[model samples]
Every structure is written in C-alpha cells, then in structure tokens.
Target: MKTILTAATLIATLAVSGAAVAQDFVQSGTTPTLPQREGQAIYNAVCSGCHMADGRGAEGAGAYPPLANSDFVESPDAVIAWVLNGYRAMPPLGSIMDDEQVAEVVNYVRHNLGNSYEGSSTAADVQAMRE
Candidate 1:
C-alpha cells in the first residue's frame, strides 16, 4: 500500500511540473526583446511626426509613404537605405541619429507597424551597409 501511495504522489508531482513548464512556454510566444522596446519608444518620439503614430502616413497628400502596411519595410536593406539616405520627400535623418538609434528606429517600425517583419536589426547591420 505504501509503495502504491508513493508512486501516485510522484505521478502527481510530475504532472504539476509539466503544467508549469507548459505555461511558461505559452507566455513567451514571440514577444519582442529589449532593443525592440527601445526602438518602439524612439519611433514614437521622432518618426511618428511625419509617419504618424500608427505608421500610416497622410494618404492623399503623398507627403510620406504609409509605413504601417508597407511591403518595403520587410526588406532590411531597403529599410536601412531609406532611413540613411531618405526618400524624395523625406529629408535625410541618417546624419542626425547615431547608428544604434537608426537600428532601433528601423526595428521599431518593422516590428510595431501594422505589417510587422519578424527579425531584429542591429547597429552593425546598418554600419555595414553605410560602408
């Protein structure tokens, strides 16, 4: 009887532990990292003015490209170049922001925008493209 009781207790403990592990995995699903958080904040401060808070630019005005659902942002190279050199209407901000800041902003737009791309951009990535 004692052996049976011990086995039952062990099984219960294993089941509880398994449940805890499963819960942890569920909570961690595809959440952004630290840099991505910073990137979001920076986007709110600087980029939001022209791009708008939701990344949707002025539609008819054609003042800025609508970044929210833009396919161009999916390409890391295109994003980097656009930020560095600026497009026709947008002035170049590459000179104003540091490499790290640029990366953070790019990452912010890519991840937080309506059409989000799943990847992180680093300062090194931007610097390499600059050269």
Candidate 2:
C-alpha cells in the first residue's frame, strides 16, 4: 500500500514537472485559428502524438504507422477497431472519447492524410464499434 502510494505520488510529481517538456514535444501540429471541425481538433490533440500531425508516423521502437494514403486505413473499420480496442502498441481511446469524437477523428483521417475515400463514418458506427 505504501509503495503504491509512493509510486502514485512520484508519477504526479513527474507529470506536473514534465508538463512543459511534454508540450514542447507535442506542439508541432497544424494549429487551426479558424472555426475548426471536431475531427481535425481531435487529431491535433490526441492521435498526433503518435501518428503525427502530417499523419506520416515516425520511425522508432516499432513504427507508429503512417495514416497518409494507408492501405490499412482504406478499410475504415480497422481504424475504428484500433482506436477502440488498440491494435498493438496503440492505446485504446474509446474509453477516453465519446462516439461523436471517434467518428470525427476517423473521418478526418480517412478524408485527409492523403486519402480520398469518398465515404464517412457516423457516430452510430463508432458507438457500435466500441468494445
């Protein structure tokens, strides 16, 4: 119990102290000044950390996998599955986000990221995909 509390306290301290450093690493995305759509905003906030702002994922310990013109994303349901249930190193974001937000981000990736898929997924679709 004491060890758990200590670990939690240490984590909180590091998070507070590293907040500035974390911001420095994550502020590379396209920051929209106009009235931005929900999808774009969510990508800039969440997926951009791993998938990147350009959707061209970076190489490191097991590449983040680029979303731009990806054959993987061509199958739209795969995107939903990965985001909701996690498909390897990618964390599950379904719990953190509502259905509408998931739909927005998934649609954003499909339409943008060098993709031209003439389709969209609704919140109902995302809701159904949730684990």
Candidate 3:
C-alpha cells in the first residue's frame, strides 16, 4: 500500500509540473513564440538541431549539407527562400517563424559559419519573398 501511494504521488506531481510547463508555452491563445529573437539565439534553438552547433552539417541516412564556408550561404535571398519553402529533407519553417526570425537566421548563417558574405538581409526582404 505504501509503494502504491508513493507511485501515485509521483505521477500526480509529474502531471502538475507538465501542466505548468504547457501553460508557460501558451500566450494569449495564439501560437507560442521562440524564447529569444536574436540571430544566434534563434539558430541555436532551431537550426542547430540539424545544422549542428558549429554550423557544420551532418550526414547519416541523409546529408544535412555543411553551411561552413559554402557559396550557397552567400546569397541571403536563396537561404531565406530555402528556409521558408523547405528543401529536399528540411521542412519549411515559414509558418513556425515570423519574417524577422527568417531574416535573422539567414543573416546569422551568412555572416557566421566561416562564410564572410557581404550585406545583411532585412525583414522587409523576407516579407517581399513571402508575397
């Protein structure tokens, strides 16, 4: 009986914690936003899952394609389009992220990752592309 009671208490505690976490994610009933808005912050939270923390991509069953010193990252528009529209294996992040976020990530990839590209993209550019 003591063991059963302990198990039940643990389950109840977990349930309450989970509910609190879920509530934190909710904002005015609309879709929740990312924790940070900075370019690097967004990259670390979202892009690094596949592209890796160092910006060097991975390959296993499928290739993630390296972003380090790649000519592809030179063009801000191209990177933005791919991120918003989705590529071969990557899913589109258009709906998940706002225009500013798309631009920030694009700019982050362009300037960092061993690729020194000229000029940074603006939110306006992303919005124009979306339209």
Best by lDDT: 3
- TM-score (all chains, Cα) for each model: 0.65, 0.70, 0.74
Considering lDDT, where higher is better, how would the candidates rank from best to worst? Answer: 3, 2, 1
lDDT of 2 by residue, 5-117 (tens): 87788677546634633553343245322122488887876777667778998654357889988888886788888878888888887766677778888899999989978
Writing each residue's lDDT as its tens digit, candidate 1 over 1-131 gives 99888778867754764464444323223433312236766676556656766888753234667899888699877888888898787776676566787898888788877777888889999999789
Order of models, best TM-score first: 3, 2, 1
Each prediction's whole-model lDDT (CA): 0.70, 0.74, 0.78
lDDT at 82, model 3: 92
Q: For each candidate in turn, give its C-alpha RMSD to the true structure in angstroms.
A: 18.6, 9.6, 9.0
Q: Over 4 Å off in model 2, which ranges?
A: 1-37
Model 2 TM-score? 0.70
lDDT of 2 at 23: 59
lDDT of candidate model 1 versus the reference: 0.70
Better of 1 and 2 by TM-score: 2
Give the distance in Å from residue 44's predicted Cα in candidate 3 to where it truly belongs: 0.9
lDDT (tens digit, per residue) of candidate 3 on 22-126: 443333445555555778877776776567667788654357888888987888888999989998889987877788989998999999989889999999999
